[model samples]
Target chain A: MRIHVQNPAGTSAFSFTRAQWDAAVKRHPDMRDLEVTIDNSDDGWSAALPVADIVLTWVDIVGAKLRGCDLSHAAPRLKLLSCNSAGVDRLAPFDWLPRDIALLNNSGIHADKAGEFGLMALLMLHNNMPAHIRSQHAQRWAPMHATTLKGRTLVIVGLGAIGGGVARLAKMLGMTIVGVRNGSAPHEYCDEVVSVSDIHKTLVRAEDLVLACPLTKDTRNLLSRERIALLPRGARVINIGRGQLWDQDAVCDALDSGHLQYAFTDVAWSEPVEEGHRLWATPGLILTPHIAADDRDRYNDITLDILFENIRAHAAGRPLPNQIDPVRGY
Target chain B: MRIHVQNPAGTSAFSFTRAQWDAAVKRHPDMRDLEVTIDNSDDGWSAALPVADIVLTWVDIVGAKLRGCDLSHAAPRLKLLSCNSAGVDRLAPFDWLPRDIALLNNSGIHADKAGEFGLMALLMLHNNMPAHIRSQHAQRWAPMHATTLKGRTLVIVGLGAIGGGVARLAKMLGMTIVGVRNGSAPHEYCDEVVSVSDIHKTLVRAEDLVLACPLTKDTRNLLSRERIALLPRGARVINIGRGQLWDQDAVCDALDSGHLQYAFTDVAWSEPVEEGHRLWATPGLILTPHIAADDRDRYNDITLDILFENIRAHAAGRPLPNQIDPVRGY
Candidate 1:
């Protein structure tokens, strides 16, 4: 299979290093037969995309690359467009993707980085960092009280790879874990399990909350104003999922009204979140520019693992891991 | 034996609740033969400080309860003064403590809480929380890159209970651990163990540095300006040990000069670091109000365990655990 590497998002600075390229090519002997072509921002895609049997892409490049070039002329052998990200939302803007092409995300692999970021958000809020920052800037030597995770309740929405990673770390910190998701199978890290419909009950008891669920038509604005109100006052909220999964107004109001201690989001509806967006200055909101998962140090290695797995599976005509259901839009 | 409880810290606020007190007193049927007396801040110490055979105290209460009352008349039966804190530094003011009295510190018990706080401080700095705070107040949508613990080198200056906890968590986060201590015995959490004399060599390669070592005359000002200079530029320092262990001027200068990224300290030379102290206003210093080990929810429970063990051992003419060496001054 011929694979074309595309960096349409213009992150040439972070393109796969020579070692990463070597690792992927040498990962398995079978990969030796696969022809790979690399592309950069300076190079025009005059011929690469149209002839690629499989397009290896970045999360942010899908829409830009697709919009800038015509992919209808893609080689008939092009069966997949593999992404190097946990979430596939960045690919949504490219509506012209061929129906025959399977969309595979690097789901479980980047979970480590994403999950670590989620854990960071929890620690930041629990430590009352906002207050500390203010004190530091004002040169105030204040020893603010920090509430530890020991014996406190943590509620995780979504039982995916990311959520599982967060659960494991939270458990180590001595938190009691309550999980909410569609599946009912027992999750070892969770002390208690609840269905998606019962998230309200979970939120009421949650001192620290995490949202790692995929966004779909069924889950848009899952954390609505009323549902957010269901959470105990002073609860902390962290979003490692799509930004649209939370109602911005509800989150801002909660922080402003002091119903929520703080809200940290790694994803936003707008990539850079326009210059003066309300979330930027919201009292208890911390707007990080959507780089949590992408900032991972082992990002390329993890993405390569996913790519290798799917490649081997495809060769055997077996089911591909992390193949997204386009209609459901994960 | 008679046990007198003195809470001049008046953590009547933090004291055992009705149920907690009941549970402790009723913990063992053998306690029925023992006598226990409780004293609050309001209670006059006219007799409380004199007649107690075994005194159970909080670290903060030592100075407060000892200074105003005369201890020269302590009962002939007075045998032990057990503290519910890991450090007996607060007892420094009581130079006249009877040489015959065995002083016991709750050393390893709160290691869990203090270590967790140490881990918290690490996560905060590595996540670039300070920059995020700046962006939040400026209402800017800037996503700063943050370094992760994955594959980074961490040097632990002590390998005690608290250091061990921090090491375990750091390992889970993918850091390589280097330990320096007086003991040459291999520590499980450290990948490389070095003697006290090798600290400067360890500091040169450390990306993250931690001090969980005890402070004595030999260890004071351990992080002197020259030693701090040996650390790789931009190294982060965390002090969960006595405040005097670090040279305040050295740390402040390092942060201001951009040689160190940040320093987080739970202990200051003075509790409630005096207002306007240089440390209070140091650019990258976080002055936590000395509650790392003190806020532990298990404080009283751990204290009780020590008391019970000592009581049983003392009655049998056996040596008590956690007995402090007056010469070593732990």
Candidate 2:
């Protein structure tokens, strides 16, 4: 089988170096027997696509005009379009994807990274790290004591790979997890599982709220102004999912009004938040520029692992675990 | 039996309220049979200590003159002196205590709180939160990605109550715990246990270093300038122990030089950190005002639990579990 690996042009966070590829090959020796080609230029894609049976890429390769390449006529043998990202929300509407080629995402690869980040976010919010950080900026020596998170309730929305990661770590930390998802399926990590329709009841008792779902039509602005108000006073908020998962303004207002004690969000409504954005100076707000889940050093390794696993499954006529359901738009 | 509970004169972190005392009594029902008197004044101590069989205090009641009251001459029935703290280094030298009196400390109560805080600090350091906070102060949207804590080496000094607490949590987070305490006895949570004398060997491999030992003659300035330099480049330092346990100036210098990636210190050489202290403006440094372990909401209740547990042990023939070894100064 022939495989084509297309990296994004210029310097990107997910850009893989040649050394990384070599290291990954050493880790997954099965790649040695395959015909592989790697490039970043559009010309390279034009050349490699025609002979490629499998293609691995970051989502940027797919756009309205398919990066101005005619993949339908060029890549006849392509059986897999593997994306090196957990969320493929930006690449919705599978009309551009050839029906013959299956799309697989790098989802479960982020579990360990998300789990650690989620726990850290929860602990930071509980211990008032954001406020303490603000105090440090002003050279203030204020000590705000906090209780342990032993019995605190967490209402985590979306029990997918990312949310499940947070749930596992949070449960281990002695928190009572209330998972909110599309269906009321019982989860191993959550103490109680409630559907999205029953989120209000869980919100009323939520001491901590985590957003770790995909940015689907139903999930956008899920935590609106009213829902923010429903959370008990001093509740902490964490958004590791897409920023559109909650109302950013409502979060800021709740934090400003002291209804929410603190908020830690890795994502923003807009990438690279412009100068003078209110979020930059918002009190009790820790804005981490969308770097919560990706472990830069191991991201490519894990992505390659996913790709290899899917390739093996495809070869064996088994269902690919990371394959995206086109109808779900995940 | 008469139990005198002398609280600090003003509002203190560990000061127990009347409601708290009543709550403690409710939790430990055996206390109902005893005559318990709670007071916060010099006059109250003068009247109560003379006839008291046990004393519960926040370590302020014992001075050179024993709070200007003679405990040996008046309090002949005093059998147990329980301090509402884990470390009794400040009250070292057992000359003031009568030979018949056994000193008990609130040690294990801090495990849960310390575990949470320790895990938070490590995560913050690993994720470069100190630098992120600095960027947040400048309203910069710089994203620094980090690897997970799994398989990372943690050289934790002092595997006592606080350090042990940190170890259990760190171990759960997939870190390799190398505990450094007074003895070389292996601990359950630590992958390897080393004595204080062999700390230099561990420092070279330490990706993260934690100071959680007591401030005794042997431990004062334990993490000296040379010791700090022994750590690998970009190593993170967390001091949740006493202020005197590590060299603060060395930590600041290392942070400034970029030899250390970040440092999260809850204690300082002299705290309330004073106006114009260099630590206030140090880059890549997070200085919290020494509120690391104490869960203020449950501190008094836990202290009462310790007191009751000790009281029960004293009633029986068994030795008080929290009783201090005078030679150890903790």
True contacts kept of each: 0.42, 0.81
**Backbone clash count, each prediction separately:** 2, 0
Candidates 1 onward: DockQ, in order: 0.48, 0.81
lDDT string for model 2 (B273-297, tens) is 8868998888888889888888978
| CAPRI grade, predicted model 1 | acceptable
DockQ score for candidate 2: 0.81
lDDT for each residue of candidate 1 in B1-330, tens digit (9 for 90 to 100): 777777654444456444554576677556666667776654534465566788877776666655444465644567888887777765664465777777888777756677677777887677776566666667677776564667889998878777887888787788899988886678887888998887887889989899888777767888888999999999999998888888878888999999999888877776666667887767667766665654535667656766777877877889888787777677
Measured against the true chain A, the candidates' chain A TM-scores are 0.90, 0.94
Best by DockQ: 2
lDDT of each: 0.76, 0.87
Off by over 4 Å in 2: A17-19, A22-31, A64-69, B64-69
Report i-RMS for every model: 3.1, 0.9
Q: Per-residue lDDT tens digits of candidate 2, residues A31-98?
A: 77777788888898889988999988887676532544566787888899888888888887666676
